[model samples]
Target: MMTVVHHRTVDVGGQAVFYREAGDATAPAVVLLHGAPASSFMFRGLIPLLADRYHVVAPDLLGFGYSAMPPVERFDYTFGALTDAVEGFLDTIGIRRCALYVQDYGAPVGWRLALRDATRITAVVSQNGNAYTEGFVDSFWKPLWDYAEDMTEEKAAPLRGALSLEGIRWQYTHGVPDTSLVSPDTWMHDHMLVSRPGSMDVQLKLFSEYPTNVALYPQVQEYFRTTQVPLLAVWGRNDEIFGPDGARAFRRDLPDAEVHLLDGGHFLLESELPAVTALMRDFLGRALPV
Candidate 1:
């Protein structure tokens, strides 16, 4: 029988955390953590593909998606807080150990989870999720990093377009060779979410705290070397942000880690949905062939 995405909400210490679950609970799970300006919605198309063999759960971080979007002023938007929220969700849902699939902003949150409790991680699949300092290349992140240092209205003003209709549209379409493959509804939905009152503030707070994740790279790399968790890193070579170098870095720490770079952009799943599905399904089978 085919499994459909199941919409469910669980209260994680009074916070209503929303997630999409599929497949059998008894099977090994694949926890999908989405990136910024997006939620579990990004994983909608990818979930059912793997649901047959693996339990899949994708949650929106505290400030993103349909999850409770508390005001930035009221809630802590740091990566640490985000990880805590995710850990709580895992606990509440009775998911003790699972494979982690991290993409974009999901990188920091998921990596922190793995580092905090390495034993809970069955394996890791990194898709355009970067951890190395070198991964933050000059092309995509330099301007954002500059804005982070100053954080003045003037400095941040230049980046406001990223939250706009066209900007969010560009985020999904830009690096892909065939722009037609990108869906307009993807950005249109995202624009509506960020357009909500106070969402921008939450984004800005998280953007400024990105350096914290960078600082954690040392610890993350150390965890990789010591724990030697099975890893499968599939990157989009065309991604301007979190470029291919980040994918290759896994080999430095875990030489046996399987890595593949595909011809897609930051939101590679958008453009290479079938290809990514095939790669992930195959990788998971090999990486966790028990």
Candidate 2:
């Protein structure tokens, strides 16, 4: 049967969680978690590619994408809360087990799920997801560290630019050699979604608490050791935020993991979609076959 994506939302508890799904329900599931300043929208091109075989599900985290963006006072925007909502969403959607593909902010969200219940996961695809301290590079980490130290609007505003057009543009262009390969709409669309009411605050909340995720890295690594989970790390070598070191760090625990450093920036699918899809398909076939 031909594969097609369906943009849908499910009520998890009282909040609205929007997601994209495709493929037959009984097929093996693949959960794609996007990074900060991005929602399931990032998976648009890749969803149809994988949906032909596996059940692909990409959901917008709370306060992201088409999901309901409640005020900070209304919904605490922490990693814990985000995971709670995601796990609940999984239950509500009736997804019992699946492979996880996590990137940037999706790293922490996806790792939390793996740590919470290892049995629910079939395999892991780490795309620029950092699970080790060695992965923390200067260019991206320093500024955020400084911003987290001082919460003043002066510091916060520039940091907030990450949620703005210029920052989004920077993320897509900086590390890429062929600038033309990156699309302007990548940032433009994200800029529109993030500009929604109280959206920046939600991202800021996550920025402020990034250390918490870092603090739990040891545990995330431990879960890998105990579960011996199969892993496939496909990283965009040019990613300024998550340097190549972060991508290679997975081998520390899962030495048998398949790792690939692609020729692109933070958002690989933006420039190297076809290559990534090929690698992911091959990896899941060998490492996570149903």
Clashes of each: 0, 0
Q: Write the per-residue lDDT of candidate 1 for residues 158-254, one digit (tens) a residue.
A: 5686788987887788779898888887998888998899989998888889988988999999999999889889888888778889899899999
- Least well predicted 10-residue stretch by lDDT in candidate 2: 155-164
Off by over 4 Å in 1: none
Q: Quantify how close model 2 is to the true structure by its C-alpha RMSD in Å.
A: 1.3
Whole-model alpha-carbon lDDT for candidate 1: 0.88
lDDT of 2: 0.87
- Pairs that clash in candidate 1: none
